[model samples]
Target: MISRGSIVVMAIGGALLIISIAHHSQEWMRVASRLGPIISVILDGGLAISLISAGWWLRKQQTTLTPDE
Candidate 1:
């Protein structure tokens, strides 16, 4: 069982991991001109997801109420 916040975090992290691994494949290999654009996309996508999820989680935590009863 996953909460919405957990799912959001997981999805963001998963996309980043998959693409980050893919984007870095060439760093350990021979450099190719075609790889630059792909890496940028991967980086951007990862950054976006990470930022959005973090923001959402922060907001949720801030808004949650504690039981006083």
Candidate 2:
């Protein structure tokens, strides 16, 4: 079964992914560019993917550990 915490994490990741995509607009891109490529890559890609992967891994672990009924 999926846990609430995992769900919340996935939700947050999804939000971040949306924000990252939106941030690519002309205005937001200008701001992000000024922040430098390293920070941009970490914030707009790594963090969101990490959160989503973590949530998915958590759910997978829980399901696998549960005994068959």
Candidate 3:
């Protein structure tokens, strides 16, 4: 079973991914331009994906290590 913390982390990551995609619009271009488009994309998307992966890994580890009752 997945832990609550893991679910929360994955949820936040999903939200971040959505925000990152939305940030690509013209209005947000100014912020991206300041950070550099490539770097901004990498930071936003990479971090989100990493968080999601971490949460999944945590859940897997928890399930594997726990004793089945």
lDDT of each: 0.64, 0.76, 0.80
Clash count for each candidate, listed in order shown: 0, 0, 0
Ranking by lDDT: 3, 2, 1
Model 3 compared with the native: what TM-score? 0.74
For model 2, how does the per-residue alpha-carbon lDDT over 7-62 read when each residue is reduced to its tens digit? Answer: 88888998997787666544455663555644665668778999999999888888
Candidate 2 regions with alpha-carbon error over 4 angstroms: 28-43, 67-69
Better-scoring candidate (lDDT), 2 or 3: 3
Clash pairs, candidate 3, are: none
Best by TM-score: 3
- The TM-score values for the models, in the order shown, are 0.41, 0.67, 0.74
**Cα deviation of 64, candidate 3, in Å:** 0.2
Candidate 3 lDDT trough over 10 residues, lowest sum = 25-34
The deviation in Å at residue 26 for candidate 2 is 3.4
Residues 15-69 of candidate 1: C-alpha lDDT, one tens digit per residue: 7766666666645365556567566657766686676677567656656856579
Highest-lDDT candidate: 3
lDDT of 3 by residue, 1-69 (tens): 668998899999999988886785443566635456566667888999999999888888888885769
